[model samples]
Target chain A: MTARSLDWESGQGERKWRRRSLWALLLLVPLALAGQAYDSVKTLLGGEDLFPRQVAWGQSAHFGGSDWKLTDLRGAFGMSSLPPDSVPVLADFSVKVGDPDLQKLWLGCKVMLIDAEGRRWSPTSAVSLKAPGDVHTCVSAIFSGARRGDTLNLRETFLVPRQATKTIRPAVGLASERPHFLFFQLEKD
Target chain B: MMRKMANVILLLLATALCYGLQVSKPHYAELIGPIPAYGKLGDAVVGRGFEARAAKVAFSRNLKVDRYGQTKVFTTGGIWAVVTVEFAASAQSTTVAVASWRGPTGLAYDQTERLSFADGLLPVAIDPGLPKKARLIFEVRPDEVSNATLLISEKLMSALDSQAEISLGPVAAGADGLPAETVDTLDLTQPI
Candidate 1:
C-alpha cells in the first residue's frame, strides 16, 4: 500500500473510462450517417407513404376542406379505344366541397390507381359523358369554384394493362400536391 | 500520427470515388430520349398512339361553325384558324383536347379563348367503346395562317405521354395576306 501504486491504479481507471467515452461518441457518427442515407433513398424512390389515411370502399373521408366518398369502381378490358391489351378502370365519387372560411375550393382533384401488386397509375383522363344511369350521366360541376353546400358528382378513368389478378383502389388529392392522400378501397368488379 | 493522416486521405479518396460514380450515371431522360407518338389524319392513333384515331379534319379561317352551333367573330387583330376533328376515343375511356398549334414560322399557340365559339374539345370525357367528335380553335397572326400544323392530344397536361400532329395545308388569304372568310377542307389524314 504505497501512495505511488494507488495513484497509478487510479490513473489506469481514468484512461479506461476516457477510451470508452470516445468509442461511444465515434459509434454515433456512423449511426447518424446511416439514418440520413436511408431517408435519402426513400425520398429518391418515392417510398414515402403517400396515402397515410385509408377509407373503405363507399365510405366517406374528409381532407383539406371537403368531404369525399367513392361510390363505385369498375374495370373492364373490352374498351374499343384501348387496343386488345389495355384495361380501363372507372371510379365514381361524390364530393361536397365547402368551408365558410375558405373562399374558393378546387374539387378537380387528381387520382392514383393502386393495383393488387402495389403498382400505381395516374388516370389517363377525368371525363363526364352522358350515359343512362347515375354513374354515366355527366355532372357539370367544378370543385375549384365550389360555394357553400355545393355537391359535385365526378368520375375518373384509368387505363392499365389487363391482368388476371387485378384489384385496385383510388388515391385522391389535389392535382399538384404530395404526401396528402385520402385513399378509397373500392370493390373490384 | 503519419499513418493516421494517410488513412484519412484514403477515406477522402474513397468518398470522392463514390460521388463520382453516382454523378456519372445517366439520367432517365437522357437514357431514353423523347417518346415518339406521331400520326397523320384519318389514321387510328392509339395509346401513346393506341386505339384513338383522328378522322375527317376540316380547317377554316373563320370559326363560322362550332360544336354547339355557336358562331363567333374575332375582335382581336389576329385571325382564327379552327380545326374540326373527329376524335374517336375508341376502347378505353380517356380525355381529349387540342394540345397546341404550330405556325409555319415554328411559333406555337394554344387553344384560343372560348369566346362565342367553343375552343377545341372541352377536355371531354369519352367512354369506353365509343367515339367522340370535337373541334379545336386557335387565334394566330394573319400571316401564320398558311401551312399551320395542329397537334391533338389525349390530355395536354400529359402531352408527352400521348399526342398526334397533323399538317394543316395553306389557308386562302386576302390581298393583305390576312386569312379569307372561307372554310377549307384538307386531307391531313395521311402522315406528312
Candidate 2:
C-alpha cells in the first residue's frame, strides 16, 4: 500500500480509539459519583422514614425482628391542663420479642402520629397521663430487657391539633428498620 | 503567531480566575452554617422554631445559686455576663439548648457550665404560646464585654437551622476600666 494510504488508516484507527475512550470516560463519571455517594445515599435511605409497611388495625405484623400489634389510638380533647385547640393522643402497642436484642435493634425508637397532609407529631411530654405499670414507652422498652417471646406493652403520647386527630395514623420506626416503618390504619377511619 | 499568543493569555486569565474563585469560596462548615436571625437587644428575633428577646444584661463577679434550700456561691476569674432572654416556641415544644456570647474580637464564649444546676438555665423547654425567661451566663474577659453579641439556637450543631443573633449594643466602662454595670454579686435564686 502507498505511504499516504497507510498514514490515513493509522490516523483513522487512532481516532476510533479516542472516540471509544471518550465514551468510556462518560460512563465512568457517574460510576465514580455513585461510588463516592454510596454511603450517603444508603444512610439517607436507611435512616429516614421514607417507606411504610402498612398493617391493618388490631392485626399483628412482624417488624424489626419482633411481632407488633397496634392496640389502640385514642384522643382526649379539651382537657383543662392541655393547651386550647389541641388534643392529646395516645398510641398503644403490644410487641412480642423475637430477637430480644432491643438495645441494638430498637435504638432511636420513635412512635409518632402522621397526618394526611404529611405533618408528623412526635411524642410529647406535655400530656401527663396515667398508664399501667407494665406499659413502657418505645424508648423505655429498649432498656426493659425482656426475654424472647415476652410481650411488652408500649405507649406514646402526642399533642396535636384537634383537626389532625381525625386523619392521623400511628407509626412505629426503629433505627434498624427505617426507612421502612410500621404504619397502622385506624379502625374508626 | 499573534492568535497563539492571545490563546495563551486567555488560558492564563482563566486559570487565574479559577484560582481566585477557589480561594474566595467559603469553607464547608461555613457553607452549611446556621442561618442567622439578627435583631437588637430589645427586639424579638423570631427564628424558624423559636423566638428570642434579650430583655436585660448584667455583669457580676459572683453568682449565688440556691437549690434545694442550699445556697452555693460560684466565683469567676473573669466577669460574669448574664443576659436575660425570653424564649417561646413557635410551632412545637422545643428546647433552647445552646447559647454563646460572641465578643467584639469574634471570640465566642459558650454559656457557663458552672450554672448547670441553676434553675432556668439554657436547654430549657419552651412551649408554644408560652414565653419563658431564661438566663445565659458567660464568663468573659472584662475588656470583651462591650459590643458583645448574644447567639441562641436550638442545639449546639445547628447546621442550616435558625440562630438568634442579638446585638447587645455598647457597654459603659467604669472609672476602674471595668463594665460600669458590674455588680459584686448576682443572686440567681430570684425569678428571672
Candidate 3:
C-alpha cells in the first residue's frame, strides 16, 4: 500500500478510538449522577432516625450485664416540681444490677432525649422520686454505685419544647465510655 | 493539533470535577449528621494508630487526691468525670490525648487544666500493641451532666478516621419518670 494511504488509515483508526472514548465518558457521567441521585433521595426519605432505633416506653433493652427497663416517661416544664411555662420531658428507668460483674461496674449512665427537631437533651441532674399513689415527689439520693441484685430507680429530665414532642426518643449510654448506646423507642400507647 | 489540545483540556476539567465531588463527600455521615452514641465498658474503640478500651470510671464533685504522699482535698465547682483508659498502640505510635467533651447542647468543651495536680491521663506516646492504661479526668458543668461525649483525637483537627468520639451515657430517670433533683452543690465533705 502507498505510504499516504497507510497514514490516512492510521488517522481514521485514531479518530475511531477517540470517538469510542468520548462516548464511554459521556455514558459514565450520567451513570455516576444517577448513583448520587439515588443516595440523595434515600437520605431525604429516611435520614433523620438513623442510629438509635426508636422504641416505645416500657420497652426493655439488654446491654452488657443488666437489663435496663424504661418504666415511665412524662413531660413537664422544668426539671423539678416547680413549674415552667415551656417544654421539658422526664424519663424514668429501672436498672437492676445483676451478677457480680454488675455490682463492681460503674453504673453512672446518662440519658439523651432527642426531640422531633433532632435536638438532644441531657439530664440536668439525677434524683430518686417517692411516688405516693400517683403523686410524684423528688428526693435526692447519693448516685454513686449499684450493688448486685439491687434495683436502682434512676430519673432524667430534658428541656424540650412542646411543638417538638412529636418524635421523642431516649438514648442511654454509660457515663464514661464512647459512642455505643442503648437506644429506646417511645411507644404512643 | 488544536483538536487534540481541546480534548486534553476537557479531560483535565472532567478529572478536576470528579476530584471535587470525591473530596466534598464525607466518608461516614448519618442522614441527620454524625451524632455520638453511648458506649459501655470493655468497649474497645480502634482509631488510626491506637485501640483504646475504657476500664474503671468515676464521677464525683470532690476528688480524693494523694499528693506528695499526703492526702489532699481538692474540690470543684462542677463535677469531675474520670475514666481509666487502656490504650494499645499500633505499629505507628502516636500521642493519645483526652481532648474535649461534646456536650448535650452540641457544643465541644476542651480540657481544663485547673485540676492539673490531679492524677489523670496526660498526652503520651504508645508502642505497637503495647497497652498502657491511664486515668483521664474531665470537669463537666452542671447542665452538661445529662449527656456528654468524650472526643479522643490524636491531633486537634485530625481526620475523622484518626479520632474516636465516645458517648458517655446519659443520666437515668427515677421510677416516677422524672430526673431526680439533687441540691446543686454536692456534699464535698463526704468520702468518695
Candidate 4:
C-alpha cells in the first residue's frame, strides 16, 4: 500500500466524525449561557431561597456569671398574663431584604417541633412581611407538646432590643419557684 | 478546537446562572434565653391543682418597695400562678422554702400554715374548689425598693423580688411570735 494513500484512506472517516462531534458541542454552548443569564437576573431581582424551614432541637446552658454584649440576637418571650397556650413554644427565623434600600428584615418564625417518638418536623415556605416597624408574624401549628427537658432554639439573626418580653405557656406542669421556661441572653459578652 | 472551546464556555455560564438565580437572603433575628429556675426545697414547694400544674413552674411577683414598680396578675377563672411556702420560718433565718401553685386563683402561700415574713409578699395557693380568678388586692407597703441603690445599680434583693416573691427576708424575733419584718395583715391586701 502506498503510505500516504493508505493513511488518508483509513483516517478520512475519523476526521469527519471528530468534526461533527465538535460542532454539536459548540451549538450547546449558547443554550447553557442563556439559561444561566436568566437565573442570575431572577435571583438578583428578589428571587433566591425565598423561604427556609427550620427544625427545633434540644439546648443546654452553663453559668458562672459571664456577661455578654451582643447584636443581632433576639430577646426572650415573657408574656405571663396571656391565657394558657396562647403562643408557640419553639420557633426558627428567616431573613428578607426589602425594596430600594433592601432594608434587612426578618420574615416569620419557622415553627419547630420534635415528637416523643423522636420524629422531627419543620414546614416553612414563604412568610409575608408585616406593615409595622419591620415586624413579621408567625402562627403556631398544633403539634404534640414538648416533654420535660425538651427544648426549642429559634434562629439567631434577628435583633431584639434590651429586656423585650414574650409570653409562653408550658405543655406540662411547671414549678412556680423553678421556672418551666428559661432564657439565656447575650449579656456583656 | 473552536467547537471544544465553545462547549467549555457553555458549562461555565450555566453554573453562574444557577448560582445567581437562587437569590434568597436570610435576615437575622435575635432571641433571648436561660431564664432562672429555682428548685429542690422540700415538700413545701409544689404546684396547685389535682394535676399539680405549678409543680415545676416558677413565677415572679412584682412588688413595689415604696413604689419602685408593681406587676399584678389576677384572673377569675382558668388558673393563676402563685408561690408556695414549704416550712415555717425561723426568726433569725431569711430564706423561706418557696414554690408555686398551679390552677391558682390568687397569690397565696403554698402550705396550710401562713407564717408572715419580713417580705411584703404574701403568697397564697388558691383552694381549687374556689373560683379560678380570685379577687386579688395588691398592697405595696412603704418598704418596697428599700434596698435599691440609685447610684450603684443591680442589687440582689430586687432581683429575687422580681422573680419569686420574697418569703423570709430580714427578720427579728418579736415577743408576739411574729417576725419583726412581717407586715400586719390589716395593712396588706387579701388573697395575696
Highest TM-score model number:
2
**DockQ by candidate, in order:** 0.05, 0.15, 0.01, 0.01
Cα lDDT of model 2 overall?
0.89
Tens digit of lDDT per residue, candidate 2, span A112-165?
Answer: 788887666778876889999999999999999899999999999888877777
lDDT of 1: 0.59
Q: Tell me the tens digit of each residue's lDDT in model 1 across B90-163.
A: 43335675457788999999887654334334465554433455556666787776777666666545524655
TM-score for the first chain of model 3?
A: 0.52
lDDT of 2 by residue, B83-113 (tens): 9999977765578999999999999999988
Q: What is the C-alpha RMSD of each candidate to the true structure, in Å?
A: 11.2, 4.1, 18.8, 26.8
Which CAPRI category fits model 1?
Answer: incorrect
lDDT of 3 by residue, B1-192 (tens): 999999999999999999999888766643333233335556887775677777754666566666666766657776666667778655433577656777789876677676565453457555432356666666776567566677776656453346666666676534543224422333222322
Estimate every model's Cα lDDT from 0 to 1.
Answer: 0.59, 0.89, 0.59, 0.27
Highest lDDT model number: 2
Docking class of 4: incorrect
In model 4, which runs have C-alpha deviations exceeding 4 angstroms?
A: A1-134, A140-189, B1-98, B101-172, B181-192
What is the TM-score (0 to 1) of candidate 4?
Answer: 0.18
For lDDT, candidate 1 versus 2, the one ahead is 2
Q: Which 10 consecutive positions of candidate 1 chain B have the poorest summed lDDT?
A: B183-192
Lowest lDDT 10-residue stretch of candidate 3 chain A: A134-143
